[model samples]
Target: MKLYLRFMGIHFRSSMEYKASFFMLGIATMIASLGGLLSLTFLFMRFHTIAGYTFSQVLLCFSTIVMSFALSEVFFRGFDRFEQIIRGGTFDRMLLRPCSLIGQILFEKIEFNRLSKVIEAAVVLAYAIPRSGVIWTADKILVLILMILGGVMMFAGMFLLFAGICFYTLEGLEVLNILTNGSENFGHYPVSVYGKWMLRFYTFIVPLACVQYYPLQYLLGRSDRSWYGLLPLAGFVFTIPCYCFWRIGLKHYKSNGS
Candidate 1:
């Protein structure tokens, strides 16, 4: 934990070195995210709802996904861009260190610029809570917090899986973006709106629904199932397999002499 804090402090100071550029890039990212928010706004203006979900309900979902994705990018982008480290031979050097490979990779880059999206998402969430028609309570608030944290875990897992694949390909796969970025885009609305098969794939396969759809149903009072609130825990579980795959890739890398 102390080592992690040290790495974070170094990165924070480095990011602070060029304050103008950092702020400009952060503003750019925030503005870019507004495009989606505007599209959702225009669509809702034309039709009151998507499927049966109210605009605010959809906003709640959007905020959660954007917040989670932004947090994941801020923390796990090193893994997302893991191929670069491998190509540059930095990963080989990383393997020589006595520290955990995952921790080292995690601290290699910390994208504070992505925090702009987190800010935007928080603004949207604040606007959404009262209008989202959710009857707030202790459990509901806890579930909402879990939903964001679980989403972070899910995206981090996706990044891990992407990095694991780089061991064989030696290049980042664009297809995997369909899981990481694509999920965030689609998650603007409820996962159920996608269709049964896609929903099932997200639920049973990727576990996206565990973070968004199921707990959201309980939050909105659409379902009476208390267990729905705990479904987000599955997102944490999803990381186990992803980490195993990463270890397997590490083993392969060691065997192949980088």
Candidate 2:
């Protein structure tokens, strides 16, 4: 952990040396994401609701997913873009280190630029909390918090899996974004608002419905049972396969020896 922190500090220092570029990227991302907020704002203006979900309800779901994604991309993005490290042989530098490759890979990069979304999500969540007007109970808040954590873990696991796939495919980086970034983009609305197929894919396949939809149902008092509130924990399942894939990829990389 100490070595990981040290590597992270180096990356932070590298980014700090280019303060203008960092802030420029941050502003650009915030601007792009504000367009998203405006779109959601107009969406509420049109129908007032979708699939039985209120505007505030959708906003909560969006904010939760965005918050988790932004935090994960901010910190866990080393895994998100690992193909570059692998292709350029930067990964070999980690093998030379006494520390675990996972730790080294984690600390290779830290993009504070991603925090622009985190700040935006925080603002949106803050605005939605009071306006949404839930009864504000411990169980409800816990469900929201748990869903956020589970969503982060699920998405991060996907990113890691995509990185692991690089060991085999060595291309198709953009395709992986269809799972990671696309999920976040689509999550701005209730997963139920999508088709029957999408809901099933996000639930049993990606576990997005487990973390986002079911818990939101519970939080909104739409669910008849307490188990709905606990469903987000199931998102943890995504990480197991992801980590297994990563281990297999690591072995393949070592065996290839190039």
Compare the candidates by TM-score and give the number of the best one. Answer: 1
- The segments of candidate 1 whose C-alpha lies over 4 angstroms from its true place after superposition are 254-258
Clashes of 1: 0
* Regions of model 2 farther than 4 Å from truth: 254-258
CA lDDT, every model vs. true structure? 0.93, 0.85
State TM-scores per candidate. Answer: 0.97, 0.94
Which 10-residue window of candidate 2 scores lowest in summed lDDT?
249-258
TM-score: model 1 vs. ground truth? 0.97
lDDT of 2 by residue, 1-258 (tens): 777778778888898899999999988988887877789889889989889778888899999999888888887888877877887788887788887787777887789898888899999999888877677898888998998898889888998898889888765468668888888888898898898999998888888888898888888888798899998887677899999999998888852345
Instruction: Tell me the number of clashing residue pairs for each predicted model.
Output: 0, 0
TM-score of 2: 0.94
